[model samples]
Target: MFYGKYYLLFFISCSPFCLLGQKAVGIGTSNPRVTLEVAGDAITRDGIEIGVIDDMVDADTSTFLVQEDASNKLKTLDVSNPTGTALGYIQEYIIENPNEDWVLNLDTNISATEFVVNTISAYYNRELDIDGYATVPNFSAYIQDGTWRLTADFPSANNLYDNEIGTWTITTLIYSRDLSKQLGTITIPMNNGSEGSHANPIID
Candidate 1:
């Protein structure tokens, strides 16, 4: 039995589905059980032929979303690990780093506040949090029309304090070459008044 459902044993021809059998094969899961039988040139309603089924699979899995890395490369995520799904992948990046901040190097020039990260897909019940001193902030970035752009800064309210923690996904990582290599480095405009020497990220 597959998922506690019983099927009849027979090879039948149907379109869009390929299962035609009433035999109970042991597949112990709560998920619905289905039986598929294919004879050359015959298909069924529950399952299609191997080649047709393969084509129906989506390239992106439901477990994770895709985001562009700092280098503009795509990365897969495991969204199941987080509490929210509607929140973007950029939110996931920030949640991974609570005590420290992050930065990225986009190959173009841009200001911080003007940056925005676009989601290729929409999720449900997502949220974001960011916490740090005002000097340098953690954020995301993206490339547009061959030029670099600064995305939005993370939301400070949801931040993880000494004992409290929050989460977010990062669609992009915009950092300077120097900060990219350092764990806790954050970027501040030359005129901003905050001052602090760089420190390695604290991992506990």
Candidate 2:
């Protein structure tokens, strides 16, 4: 009876080690293909740390985490070799005349290499009161000489008795090639003519 009890105790103690060495451990699964596999979602009270090194480094907006297929390792990528889209910068401008070619200056932090002009788009939401009717003007925004420009082809007043006056809210969306980088939006307030009796149809 003493020998039988000792054998039972030894088997119970070595059973876990034998099972670990034989097959992988699985949670919520009958079969596990890896060292440790979870068939369902898992929750980690402490934040997960990736990569081989355990250094404490802060991640920025331009930083991305990726897993390598061959090595099966996690790594961090920056804007230089970004894996996905990144948020860029934004700048705004106010112009008094839409008929004139207005030059836009970029922000100091924005680099030309970060965005392309082809991916930039501009739009405006405003209508002119002409002859007791609403009329929309042709406005355009483009980049030239390494700077953004805005222009408009507004229709002239019907006669000397008529005058055009209002404010236009123009928005520009800028992005990089392959849509990997979004440069941000530009809000422009365009003021046409003046208020009161001094208002004229002249577009300068």
Candidate 3:
């Protein structure tokens, strides 16, 4: 008789947990796909603090990551063009490319509906791709005869700062090439290095 009364009290105490076992727990999803499936926007309230320092290392550390140009700017060309249609101008592209394989477009903003012929450089002939043959290529434009050069890359990802310095390097230029003096140098504050800024890399 005493055992039956003790058993009844135990069942009543565990009744709430037994009922919960019949229903699946969900955070944001009404019908969870898995045991712990989470659905919805998630944001951390604080900066991630790592327990170990080894997690910061990566497999590939060569070539700094560059952000693509935010927008295309029109700059007046000092070089004169033989055409009488209009003033000479080129697209001053300022961008960042993570892959480092930047393709120069005549105009990224150019639409099929618009009729515009961008001016080409007298000193060089450019194209959408290297050696693709161009019609008045103005950027990545090769000189009639030029030598490809190499230079140092831009500030590494580890050297990034909060204050963005105005840059003309455009995904900005790094270890860039200087095809007949077309590649300009990137000056960084007091340590400006233009001698080997644009390293002309021949695309294979």
Query: How many steric overlaps are in each model, in order?
Result: 30, 0, 21
Clashes of 2: 0
Give the candidates in order of TM-score, highest first.
Answer: 2, 3, 1
- What residue runs in model 2 are displaced by over 4 Å at the alpha carbon? 1-113, 117-135, 157-166, 178-204
Encode model 2's per-residue lDDT on 107-191: one tens digit a residue: 2232345564332333333343356555445555555555555554445423222333333344444555544645465544445
TM-score of decoy 1 = 0.18
Compute the lDDT for candidate 2: 0.50
Pairs of colliding residues, candidate 2: none
Ranking by lDDT: 2, 1, 3
Q: RMSD of candidate 3 to the true fold?
A: 21.5
Give the Cα lDDT of each candidate: 0.39, 0.50, 0.36
- Model 1 local distance difference test score: 0.39
- TM-scores of the candidates are 0.18, 0.32, 0.19
lDDT, candidate 3, residue 61?
Answer: 31
